[model samples]
Structure formats: C-alpha cells, structure tokens
Target: MRISALAAEAGLPVATVKYYLREGLLQPGTATSATQASYDEHHLRRLRLVRALTGPVGLSVQQARSVLQLVDEPGDDLYSTLGRAVGALPPDGAEPAGADDPYPRARAALEALGQVYDPEFAAVAQLEGALAAADDAGMPITPERLARYGSAAADLAAYDLERMPPEPHAAVEYTVLGTALYEPVLLALRRLAHQDAAVRRLGREA
Candidate 1:
C-alpha cells in the first residue's frame, strides 16, 4: 500500500500521515520509486499504534516517540522496558515535591500496605500528590481506606498483567495500551459501584 492507503486504512488524513512521517513517528516505507513507496502490514500496525498513543492515550508526539523507541528497541529485560515505558507515559514537567514532605507520607502509605516499591517511582510521586491534595482538602485517605484501595488495585493489576504477552515488545505495548484504555473503565466502574452501594444503603436513587 501507499501512504494514502495507509492513512485511509488507519483512519487518518493524508496530511496527518505525512506529518507523522516527517516527524519520524512513522517509519518510511520501502522505496519503489523516487516519489513512491510501498508499505505493508507492519506499517499498518505501527500506524495504528501511533494513533492510539497520540490520540486516546493523550501523549504528546514526543512522548509517543519515546514509547515507540522503547518498543522498537526493547532493552535487556521486559521488566525494565515496561518500567521505562510506564515512566514515559506521564506528560513531562512534573516538578518533584520537596523531598522530605510527600516522600514520607507516600512511603509510609506504601509501607503500611506492605508494598515493595521504589520510593522514587513516578507513581509514588503521583500518590504523594494525591495524598497531599486530600490532606489539604481535609478529606485525607485514612489508612484503612488506603489499604482497601490498595488491595483492590493490586488485584486489578494482577488480573491485567496476567494476560500480557511474554514477549518484551508485545508486553510493553499491551501494558501501555491497557493502562491508557482501561483506566476509564475502572473509573466508570468505581462510580457505578458507589451509586449501587448508595442505593442499597440509602434505599433511594443515588
């Protein structure tokens, strides 16, 4: 297929596809002539992945490139590649909270749950930010509530990761895409569950 076909099949505009090509987000096709190139299924799959990353995943082009780079050149281990891919998903420019403040709270929360995690992990920072905001709002997540949420999250993670492919590239792709796509489902389910619980407890619409 040609670039136009590739774009059409990927449900994108030709100009957008050209832009991706120019930005090095999409790989060049096999040169058939000075003005023409032939693409294959590999290109189609890559194009779709690029669209998913930039569109639904809400990553900047640069961030998508970073993730694609990892997919193209997975490092020595799947675990590290996955960690880096996850680390790359969040938009850049999140200034770390002061070391002493959020770290202690976040670390303690994780410790209370017996979670073995890197204190410096991006998610730990995210958790710290959430905790700090809740504290400021006077609706702090108590230890019991934290433990409940932590247990549910752990179970969800297990269910998600168990289905991931063993291959490094596929595993990274699955992790990134699943994280992006399934988060909304989780949030919706949580809200729905709250509604159901309210109806049960209050005996009225909630």
Candidate 2:
C-alpha cells in the first residue's frame, strides 16, 4: 500500500502519518520511486501500535518514541524493555521506597507470599508514593495491610500474566498495553468496593 492507504488503514490522516515518518517514529517504506513508496502489513501494525501508545496509553510523542525504540530493538530483553517503559512514565509523587518505608515492607510481604518481583522496578514508585500519601494523611500503613495489598496485587499479576503471550515481543506489548488500559478498570472497581464498604460499615456514602 501507499502512504494514503497506510494512513487510512491505521485510521489516521495522511498528514499525521507523514508527521510520524518525518519524526522517525515510522520506518521508511520501500522506495518504489523518488516520490512513491510501498508499505506492508508490518508498517500498518507498527502504525497501529504507535497510535495505541500516543492515544489510549497517553504517552507524549517523545515518550512513545522511547518506548517504541525499545520495542523495535530485536536484541532487547522483554522484561527489561517493559521496565524501561514503566520507568519512562512520570512519577506519581513517588520516589523509590526507603529501607524503612512501607513500600519496601509491602514488597517484602509480597515475597513472603511467594510472589517475588523487583522491588526496585520503576513502576513501584506508584506504591511508594501511595505509602507516602498515607503517611501524610496521618494514617500510616501497617505491615499487615501492605502484606494483604501485596498478596492481592500478586493475584492480579498472576491473572494478567496468564493472558500474556509466550513470545517476548508479544509479551512486552501485552505488558505495556494491559498496564495502561486496565488501570481505569482497577480504579473503578476500587471506587465501587469503597462505596460498598462505606455503606455497609458507616451507613452512608463516602
């Protein structure tokens, strides 16, 4: 297909496709002439992935490019590529957990439950930030709560991993896309659960 067809198939405009090409986000098509080129299914698939990152995943173009760079590298290990992807996101007011911090304690508790993951993984900044916020709110998290949350997260991770493909590239794609998309679902469920708990225990909506 040509650039117009590629754009149409990817559900984007020709101008946007051209912009991506200019930005080095899209690889150049096979040159059929000085003014014409041919794209294939690979180009379409990559374009779709680019759209997925910049649109629903909410990455800026630069961030999307960084993630795509890792994704496109044949030699990059999947998990490490995912780590960089997670790491690339802006921090949610969280730093890495200190030794005495509840975040590390939570990860440790997770380990005790036989659900070991990298405590230092960049995304854990979210947990550390949450722990910091709880402390700021005058309700410091206890080790027990951390353990329970860790265990629950581990359960969810297992479910998530079960659905991932065995291929490295596919697995990395799933990891990135799933994490980006499912956060809203998790937040909604949490809100619903909180409402239910409040009604049951406090006899009022919170």
Candidate 3:
C-alpha cells in the first residue's frame, strides 16, 4: 500500500504515519522510487498497536518504544515478553529505593509474602517506591496488610495467566493489553466491594 493507503487503512493521518516512521515507532516503507514507498500489512498492524499503546494504554513515546522493542525481539518466552512490556512503564517517580530502605519496608514486606520476586523488576520498584511514599506521608502499611494485598495480587495474576491462550505472541499481547486495560476495572470493582462492606458493617437500619 502507498503511504496514503496505509494511513487510511490504519485509520491514521498520513502525517502521523510519517511522524511515527521518523520516530522509529513505525518502520520505513519499501522504497519503490525516488519519492515513493509502499507499506505492508505488518506496518498496518504495528501502527494500530502503537496507537493502542499510546492511546488507551497511556504510554509515552519513549515508554511505547521500549515495549515495541521488546515485542520486536523474538525468542522471548511469553511471560518474559509480558514482563518487558509492563516493565517499560515509567516508575512512580518517587526517589529510587534500594534493597535496604527503612521507610517503605517494602522489601521486607515482600519477603514476608513468601514468594521469590525480582527486586530489579520495574513493577517491584514502583510498588516499593509507593510504599516508601506512603511511609513518608506518615501512613506506613503493616506487613500483614502488605502480605494480604500481595497474596491477592498473586491470585489475580494466576487467574490472568491461566486464562491466556497457548500461542506465545497472543499470550504476550493479551497479558500486556489486559494488564493495562483491566487495572481500572479491577479498582472499580474493589471500590464497589468496599462500599458493600461499609454498608454491611456500618449502615443503620432503614
């Protein structure tokens, strides 16, 4: 397809496609002449994925680039590819915490959860970073509570992984897309559950 047709097929503006090409988000089309190029189906698919990541998934250009780079690298197992995708997100912007941070105590709390986790994982860093932030705000969470949350989150992950398809790339795509899209859905459900609990425990007879 020509650039115009490629943009039309991808539901993107021609200028935007060119911008993505220049930004390395989209590959350059096949050179057909001095001023003409032809894109293919792969480019179309990639453009859509790029839009999805930047649009609903809310990744910045650099972050999306990292995720796409991981996707482009073949030979990663589905699980590791998904990890790379999630890890590309910017951290919580709190100061970088180390293995021995007294404030959040997240490392100790995570250890107490009884699961071996990579301390270097970006998600772990963000979690522990948020814990440190909470501690700094004078609302330190007890290890017991952190354990509860961690266990529940593990359960959620299990459910997610168990339901994934067997195809490796499909599994990777589903994991990345589901994790980004369903977080708010999960939070909303939690909020509703909280409301129900509140009413059950504290509501007056009416």
Give the range where candidate 2 is weakest over 10 consecutive residues by summed lDDT.
Answer: 101-110
Per-residue CA lDDT of model 2 for 59-161, tens digit only, reads 8999888878776672546667778776765545465545565366446545666754565676566765676678899998787777787678878988998
Candidate 1 C-alpha lDDT tens digits along 1-206: 99889989999999998898999989999999999999999989999999999988899999999999998888888777887888777633234656555476777898899997575556776777778779999999998999999999999999998999988888888998898788888999999999999988989745
Top-scoring candidate (TM-score): 1
16-123 in candidate 3: lDDT tens per residue? 999899999999989999999999999998999889888888898888888787766625566667777777654453445444653245557767887666665567
Runs of candidate 3 with Cα error greater than 4 angstroms are 29-41, 76-81, 93-104, 165-168, 195-206
Candidate 2 stretches with Cα past 4 Å from truth are 74-76, 96-119, 193-206
Error of 1 at 51 (Å): 1.1
- Ranked by lDDT, the better of candidates 1 and 3 is 1
For each candidate, the alpha-carbon lDDT, in order, equals 0.85, 0.78, 0.79
Q: Which candidate is the best by lDDT?
A: 1
How badly does each model clash, as a count of residue pairs? 0, 0, 0
- Tell me which of candidates 1 and 2 scores higher on lDDT: 1
Error of 1 at 52 (Å): 1.5
The TM-score of predicted model 2 comes to 0.78
Q: In candidate 3, where is summed lDDT lowest over 10 consecutive residues?
A: 95-104
- The local lDDT score (0 to 100) that residue 197 gets in candidate 3 is 97
Clashing pairs in 1: none
Clashing pairs in 2: none
